[model samples]
Target: MAHPSSSHSRLFRASLLALPLLLGGAAWAQQPPPAASAAAPAADPGRHMLAEIQVIPRPVGTADDRYKHVDAAIAVIQASGLRYEVHGLGTVVEGPPEKIWPLLQAVHEATLQAGAERTLSIIKVSGGAQAGGPRVEDLVRKFRN
Candidate 1:
């Protein structure tokens, strides 16, 4: 029997190992980033009456991609007199449920204006929940003491 060359053995092991690592990396890359916080309780059951908008603009091939999206979104919301916090996946704007509705509508429009043909949103209302009742600002005010 002939012995395998040392170089050939090393090369064979490298080739075998590379496949799983490459495949694993591809799988990880496909997943979306996680949301910053757990879901807030819906104000009403089966209806999350809050704005959860996502702007999925087509890749613009820019060096500063995030800026393009943020700037566009901010411009649209600001023009409509709404304030927002930029979360990693999207922005979050808080207000009374009624006020939130119109603002969310503007978020949809803003995503459209940002050149996203396919924008998505999850609107739900939550109040009187054990996890944490709504009015995040109120909680903050209480914590200040």
Candidate 2:
């Protein structure tokens, strides 16, 4: 029987390592090409209440500084005749879509006025028939204290 040399042993080990990579690359070869613009946003015309929020000047600095800014912003928003709750560093204010939109705009303007340098993200929540978009109807279902 002939024995393999050191060079042949090295080559054999290298080929073993390369086999899995080659097989994985071949698996991707059969997939179809992607579309030009990818998937489009489907229009949900289900009368959903969508909240348009502007989260300007989010907490970017230290935790204490961020808390200060958040608290101040929350105060201003709270004074605007709305019910709000601050969960951790985020604020959750519930109301009609129309009311929430204006509140978000106010929050953005106030945050800028309070000397916020960081950019804020705007978010929206659309609760369908499940929650009815934070209407005044929730008050009627309140639990007896």
Candidate 3:
């Protein structure tokens, strides 16, 4: 025998509590449809794309005192035929994405083949709207002197 006004207030409070969950569910469900394949690139590549890559390999318990695995990766980069510059931290290569992606993979594999048990690579890509970004030479021009 609850009062009619009291029952209406209880229902209103319950709905207020449920509103957020309902809205959140709707927002989550509104996400764009999935792409046809997982391997698809996120965006279309422009004519010029640049990638800066650094490969570091840990060659467990070696006293050679030289980074042979890193050297192996460098050799792969050199042979990639893409425009590249070797810096103290990483190497920057400018070219089309189609070429740069495989080149990065090859560098990682080459380091492993050179006897590294574990390898870590850092990569940064700039293209599309940033296609006109500075090249490697531009960054190192003042230092070249």
Kindly list the per-residue Cα lDDT of model 2 for residues 1-145, writing each as its tens digit. Answer: 4456877998999988777668776555566767776664544443335343545465543454755544556777788666665545466666554566667777766665666666575666656654345443353358535
TM-score to true structure, per model: 0.42, 0.44, 0.61
lDDT of 1 by residue, 1-145 (tens): 4467977898999988677567786566567888766866445433222344555554421365655644565566566544455557766565445466767677666656666555556544343323334453553566665
lDDT of 3 by residue, 1-145 (tens): 9999999999999998778678777566567877687585654454667788888888722577477888888889899888998888888898877788899899888889989999999999876664455676776789875
lDDT of the candidates, in the order given? 0.56, 0.59, 0.81
Over 4 Å off, model 3: 1-46, 60-62, 129-133, 139-144
How many Å off is the CA of 131 in candidate 3?
6.7
- For lDDT, the strongest prediction is 3
* Candidate 2 displacement at residue 78 in angstroms: 0.7
Model 3 TM-score is 0.61
Candidates, ranked, TM-score: 3, 2, 1
Worst 10 residues of 3 by lDDT: 38-47
Candidate 3 lDDT: 0.81
Candidate 2 residue 112 C-alpha distance from true site, Å: 1.1
